[model samples]
Target: MKILLATDGSSHAQAAESLLTSLPVPSDSELCLVAVVEAPTWQSDVASEHAALREELAGYRREVEERLEREVERLKSRFGRVSGVVLSGNVVEQICQLATDRQADLIVAGARGGSKIRRWLLGGTSDRLARHAPCDVLVVRPRDDSAEPARGLKRVLVAIDGSASSRGAVERLASLPLGEECEVIVFQVLAVVRSFRMDIVEQSGDLWEAERRQAHDDLNWAADRLRPVTPHVRTVLHEAEYVADEILTVAEEHRADLIVVGHQGRSRVSQFLLGSVSSAVLRHAESSVWVVRTEDADVS
Candidate 1:
């Protein structure tokens, strides 16, 4: 498999790199390490700072290139066949172009990069890459001090709500270039765990235990459906008040290095609302996340 891993030197970015070490890519498979540098623009008010800013920007680019070189060297030692490519341009645009030009099978990146709030408000670089890239994408989170990294995906946790998008996530997981020894933990979370119907509002059920059992059964059924793809898979059911919290908990308990989930488009009304659990997991999980969305009109 040919894979492109993008980094920006953030801890979250390196977390993505760490996850790749556990993937079962063949020793002969190719890996590309790319770090993009967006040309710095000077403000009119700070015109006098142009030369200084340019120098500083050039220095930063050199630093990133050196970092990429070292990382590629380390990766080649592990994967046996890997190369590095560094470029200066718009981060998201450059990554997409590189992935398409190289016919990369997968593009890996950090879930949240240098600016989380900025990305959230103005659309994240990772989010844009995922939407526009030609191949599958793996958006990994930084290692959280509160959580320990999984040795490997001992048990994979998948979130399915019976959507084709979610199903796509399952299919992608089945096709991952993983080692034969790896196992899977398939599961799902009910976003609205409880809903009150008092007055006109729907409320969450008080029978939380029963809801949990039902959720478990749903996940079990999904796992059974995936048995053909992976015989070593297990099923889990979780019922929590919030989706993201439940996912992180399950990940910590199962020690999952990779979390596979399908992307459900956000409604316009909800776009400004709290981000989805998958996004939250991307932000918080001490693991790699693969978000499967419907194949777009643009096919590489």
Candidate 2:
């Protein structure tokens, strides 16, 4: 796997590094550690002052480079075939560009950062990468101080909604090497679209039946997709009005260590107002979430 790890020298980014150290990647896998020096937008009338700007930016760029070097050494001690890069630009843009330039298979990153309000108001770099990268993306949340491994996904939960995006997550789960002893839980949450109260009451029973059948069929399809990986797996069906709420509820009820989810890219404008579900999951879930974005999105 060609993995790209985006670090900002924050504790959140360090958390991501810790998770990468434990991932069961192949020994031959290549890793890229990246840090970006953001350019300030002040002093815009510098058409003739390019040299001055470069000189001013040089110090910050050097700092970012040094941090990248230190992180590279830390990762190298734990993983194989690692390299580092330091770039000057907007953080999210540089991340996408690097991922594309290197043809990374995955981009891994932290959920929250030192700038929590900025990230929450304007989706963080990790959230942006998940939406726009050209490879699979993994957003790792900081572990709860009280939560221990507890057998490592002995009861893995796969959230499905029968969409192409959800199918992508299911296929990814099936491809992973969950040892024979680990049990897989194929979970599908039936999303109930809200409408007029009369309409909801009129079709509640019929909608429930249809959703039940669809969940069964979806679980079967997901299981078959994983047939190449694990032959023994169980499927669970859940129904809830709100997608995020139900997912957290199920995770808490089952004490799920890892929640696998699919990401459908949302534009920056919409993300600014209503945050994406994946982003919400990262903030709210008690357990870690393994977000599976598009093939084009990197797993940072």
The lDDT, on a scale of 0 to 1, for candidate 2 is 0.69
**Candidate 1 lDDT over residue span 55-137, tens digit each:** 87788778878888888888877775788887876788888899879988788887766621123211477766765667778
For model 2, residues 1-300, the per-residue Cα lDDT tens digits are 889998776666776677666655666789998877776655666765867777767866777788788778777766678899887667788988899998988888766554211232125576667667777777666556422234334556777766666788887787677666556677776665566677665767786787678779989999888666666677877666666787788878877767888775322122211155666765577666776765543332
- Each candidate structure's TM-score, on Cα atoms with residue i matched to residue i, is 0.71, 0.77
Worst 10 residues of 1 by lDDT: 265-274
The C-alpha stretches of model 1 lying farther than 4 A from their native spots are 44-48, 77-81, 111-123, 146-151, 177-181, 190-232, 238-245, 265-277, 294-300
Give the Å shift of residue 6 in candidate 1: 0.8
Overall lDDT per candidate, in order of appearance = 0.67, 0.69
